[model samples]
Target chain A: MTAVADAGLDLRQIEQFLYREARYADEHDYDAWEALWTDDALYWVPAGDDAADPRSQVSVIYDNRNRIATRLKQLRTGKRYSQSPPSNLRRVISNVEILGTEGSDTVVGANFVLVESRTRGMEIWAGRVTYKLRVVDGEIRLAYKKVSLVNKDQPLPTLAFLI
Target chain B: MDCVTATVPQAGTDRPDYSALIQPERVHGSLYTDPRIFAEELERIWYRTWVYVGHESEVPQPGDYVRKNIGPQDLVMTRDREGQVHLLVNRCAHRANLVCEDERGNSNSFRCPYHGWTFRNNGELLGYPYHQGYGGRGKLNLGMATVPRVESYRGFVFGSFAEDGPTLTEHLGAAAGEIDRLCRLSPEGEVELNAGWLKHRTRANWKLLAENETDGYHPQFVHGSIFSVTGSPIGALYSEKSTAVTRDLGNGHSENDLRPEFRRHGEPMRWFGTTPDRVPDYVAKMRQAYGDEAEQILVEGAPHVMIFPNLFIAEIQVFVIQPLSVDECVQHSTAVQLKGAPELNRRMISQSIGSVGPAGMLLADDTEMYERNQVGAEQLRPEWLEIRRGMHRERVDERGLRVGTATDETGMRGFWSHYKTLMEDDK
Candidate 1:
């Protein structure tokens, strides 16, 4: 691990990649969203404020690559009742920063406010996201994505769509 | 503010008789919406019957306590010195302010924030800040009042506000077998609730959750995506006529029995998140503990048991439904872990989370349906919601319990019958 100067990384490009990822997920572009992740990706949304060990504490979403793939397949089938009429989602990702680098992976952090509209009503979902990004074949791919919801500690409503 | 104020129905309004609302084959929509009926239910059913408060494990040590609500009453379930469990009214004996507002904690005594009235963990009044001010003027018997009846069966504690009624065992009836089976699954013949729980609120009537727990028809539609993804045999097993059955276990308790052959062998497949690789090891451990009987204990499918009024033992999770209002309820789901099986417990926790919580694939759909059903029930056009799916096919078994096919409404009918009796009771 080495401390990298901000000037050394393409912040705009990274933000663009993050924005595209959010857009793909919002639009239910399953294949495109799936392609953005590495084969060994970890998608997680911890249940509480403090980061929790998924193996020990309960998590909202703690899926490995295989489980994520399975979930995508289910959503693609157009029969997932929770998301049959997919949530209308729009996210504003801000506070993007390059924390450092771990070997070939770049650590990035950002704050997100996602507005989701569904049958029941519209809800505002705010969260912090930490990503472990690795450049594979000159394209950035997500090795890990961790979401810490603002209201994670409280009893939550249905979160059918990906945050 | 007085917390123990009684809710008196408005005068001159004809209180709709529940007997007219709940027929054998159908129930009126007002059963899910009327505030007066809801208030009556709290008084008649919830207070009179044994409502589950908390598991003993939640307050295992002396001084440990958890706040619980039964109907409209707020209570604190505590384990005092000498290991006796007590359910005390949360309101202070003085001005009726809440003594303990936190969800749960360990405390020697509860000190009321307003007016400094204090009570011991066992609910004995310790003292007030300025007790001399009373000065033999007013007879202040300020000890916190315990619920009239509190009893525990196999570590599950229940309380009744009524002074007299059926014993906890008599009330549990055949449903006691469900709790026993859950306990016997553990090698130590004990289950613990040390792991954290998930709480979710649904915009639906509390009764809807009870009915949905044993409703076999909705899973195919509501949870189809989960089945499609996990490739679980639940979809097929539920559809097979000979495999799945819903039984009115009597006294309003009902169970949806899945995979009867496996259940008969005692190797029920109800363990959530059980992968093929984990099965051999888990089954081996069970064999090591219970010998040949382990096959039945370890491999049997978990039956979804709905104990009337509040508790639902859904295989890997214990769900308690709390009614907040006529059309709102909160569901608390605690993952069940076997006392000695760490690996199996881990799988159970994972599976419980997978199928429940806000992000759960199955529960999210069910919650949506509950809300939709509540909204639909508000419409006056369809005054009745039918519960006659398998009425013609229902039959009484040798045990005198009513039984029907998996997709039948036998369980709902049983529930409504008991509900009508309780609601119509003059006592």
Candidate 2:
């Protein structure tokens, strides 16, 4: 990895990256989403307000490489319990802020409100998302993506999609 | 609908005469939907029993408190500086304001937001902010208000609102053996709650859930969607598996042991421990520490035990079903991690939480059935819930335990037999 002055992490680049990622997900291009992560990427959706560590608390989606692969297989499986009829979701990401840096991990924070609907009804899930990105091969790769849902402790209807 | 007309023989030293109330094949529908019945249930049943509260591990440190609801009351289970647990009513003595607003946390002391009434972790009153206003008294009203009676058995904490309620051990008779068996799986013979609970609010009466949990008949039909996905079905998921074995624990407690056919083969599919890695280091080590038969039986998931009323415990976790009202219920799920198990084994047990927690695939399926049942039962006739699957095989023994087919409604009948006793009390 080469160091450079202002690696284009300004508002435009970050905004474009998020918009492109969301568009790719909407188009069902999971390959593009997979490419955004490093080989040892970590994806975590925390169970509550605090996510200082995933080891102590319950997490909605805690994925290492192996777990991510298993989850992706389940999503595509025809018999996934919650997705028998499939669910539609739209994630609105906003209020992006750069929360300084931690060694090699560049911490970025944002707010997200995901609107999901299925045969049940519509539910609005709001949360704070933190992305720890690492610069690799002149591209930003996700080291970790953590989301703290507002109603994490509540008994939700289901999680049929990747929000 | 009042208690006057509902009066029946009281449960006594002699066997209860439920002949008029409970029939071998059917029971009066009043037991299911009546508010008068539910109120009497609160008085003579749930209050008299040793209802389980939060696990001791939830409040591990001093000044740590977690809010919980035991039957109809809200309580706070706290651990003081000496690492002793206390279950106190959440309401403040003055104006009855709840002391701890957050679900769980560690604090120096609990101070009422309305007034400045403060209390120590052990539930002792500290002092009020404006003490001089009350007759210029020094440390006036510093004594603590009455707290609920608290007790613990195998890290499971329980509270009794009434002074004369049965002791925790006495209330948990035969079920006590089940709890002890679960704790013994850990090398230290203890387990701890790792984190805050996973809570779910469902639009269904709480009693329905308590019955459904031990009723071995509903899983094949109700959880069909979950089974359709996760894995293959177990042999016990058939209608023919309805042999119900009911154990009678005196003092209003009973256990429904479903003798599903697979149990005879020493392999209950629901009881199988599916670890991410089949050859777990702990299992191997446990084989070395404790012999093969001990390892096989303990490791293999078998019996599902539900303590009478609302304390639901099984091999892996403990769930407390708190009824918010007649039409609403909230379930708190806590996963118990064995103390000396290998790290991955603990993680595997924790992963089992995924199958039961708020986002649990299996729970999502079961909840739909409960919601549908609640809504449908309200509209349909009560007899529609006729639980007479294996009515002819019931045999009452010397222990007062009833034996029947596993898939039979005998377990449910056993529960209602106790339920009828409670409902008939005040009525």
Candidate 3:
């Protein structure tokens, strides 16, 4: 395949992966969501506006694969009262920006708006998504999925759902 | 002016008839819902108290500035060119417009966005756009009014609104020991706030959080699922098997030390590293930096303590609760990292942050409970949020406030007693 077609194919595959992940999250199919990541994958939801790094400042959620599994396990075991009713979430990923790559990882960016419906009501969150993806056995795996929320600085209710 | 002056009450003196406003354990709903009482609190308590402005690290460099709101007043906490920190009123002396719009940044001086009137970082009079038009009335008329007094305890900075109130140290009182304890844990004896904070709004009264900080009785029940998920029982954290202990530390300070016994006692391998989950490498790093003993000491802090009214400092983290309206409050949770500590310690700080932040499982439960309380209180019944845990113990010592356990309600009683004193003081 030509390089252009190859890039197009890779982007399409990544989009499909994100769509699948969102479906699993909304449906609470955390097992499928777990499969989308490399064993060493990182999922970060930045707390503040300029949260480029979680090492220094507070992050909304900074979970490695293990921590994520723990969180999912906790949520599934009916032990997390915060998830008593279970938050219903729907995520829309658009405005795909292919910001090129840096050493072994394909850097792709997109805009995501997540709508979470709880017993209270629906909360809409918009943010920029930066994905660092690497191909493992011809399947794209998430190295890092960094979400910089638009209302990061604004006081938020408990952000139970992942963006 | 005399009537208005008379209305401004003194604390713990000529006490107003606040018996109707507050009870021994519970306060009237008007304390949270009434705008008039809220205004009185703004004028009498929040304004007079030594409120935390910001950290020195927030404005580490000269010209670095951060904006804060104390009660209804807007303030600009800035570092001057000479490295002196100043908490100046954001209102321009001329037209009362805010001088800075951005929350934080490095600025040599502040220029009113509405007009081009500029003031130095130290709130000194600077040139105006119409300087020639103002003629000789520049320095004499335009000198910036400073915020009465600004002081620093360790690296934590605070501002006082009144010119006659007690010094920041005096206002801090027994609470200073807790801050010092947190600072002393670090070998360098200094702590710096990490970059930005997690600012989020809650649909509940601000005082609810202040009460919750010192409230030990609610955690196990409110955070039932979180406790269950963590696998370790609450009985482990408290020394006493009591539900929770709230202790009056005297001088408006209190400790709601959740007793280790309240948690599942003696859960072996309780260290963050030993958990089945992927241990954050930062946790191991923190353990190494402090050595085994230091690590143990660090983990032993009484989980929740509030420094009256707005400042709630727990577990090396500081959260400022600002009342936005009767039904809502905005909380700013700033992550504090021990200066000169190992990088892993800072990372562990972040890991610990995950449990209490706006998105943390613990806070999520707390916030949900608070909303429920707020909604429940709207019915105007005789219902009271029970804070009567550990009422039997009356002993007090150098720990200042003594608690039955971490889950006792002594903290609430301490907070309410002070609240009543402040509300009733007919000074």
TM-scores computed on chain B for all candidates: 0.92, 0.83, 0.84
Q: If you score just chain A, what TM-score does every candidate get?
A: 0.93, 0.84, 0.87
Which ranges of candidate 2 are over 4 A from the true structure? A1-43, A64-91, A97-108, A116-122, A131-144, A153-161, B1-48, B81-83, B105-109, B136-147, B222-303, B381-383, B394-400
TM-score of the first chain of model 2 = 0.84
Write one digit per residue (lDDT tens) for candidate 2, span A73-144.
554554444554556767888998888787777788889887777654687888888887777776777788
Question: What is the Cα-based lDDT of residue A8 in candidate 1?
Answer: 40
Instruction: Put down candidate 2 lDDT per residue, B1-427, tens digits, no spaces.
Output: 2232333334563433445446656654435455655665577666665677878878888888887777768778888888888877777766788787888899868889989788886767777777677655344555334345788888888777667656778777767877776765665667777655667666677777777766666666655544554554442444463443544444434455543333554542234434425635655555555675554444344346667778876546567888766666777775567677756344644465456654565565566666666666565344335657666766776766665555656667667666665545642
lDDT of 3 by residue, A1-163 (tens): 1122223336677677777766887887867777778888888887755635677667778888877877777677665666777788888999886788867778889998888887767788888888887776666667888888888766677776656
The per-model DockQ list reads: 0.55, 0.22, 0.49
Q: Give the TM-score of candidate 3.
A: 0.85
Better of 2 and 3 by DockQ: 3
Better of 1 and 3 by TM-score: 1
Best by DockQ: 1
Q: Where does candidate 3 stray beyond 4 Å? A: A1-8, A49-51, A101-105, A134-140, B1-17, B137-140, B143-145, B232-235, B238-245, B257-304, B398-402
TM-score of every candidate: 0.90, 0.78, 0.85
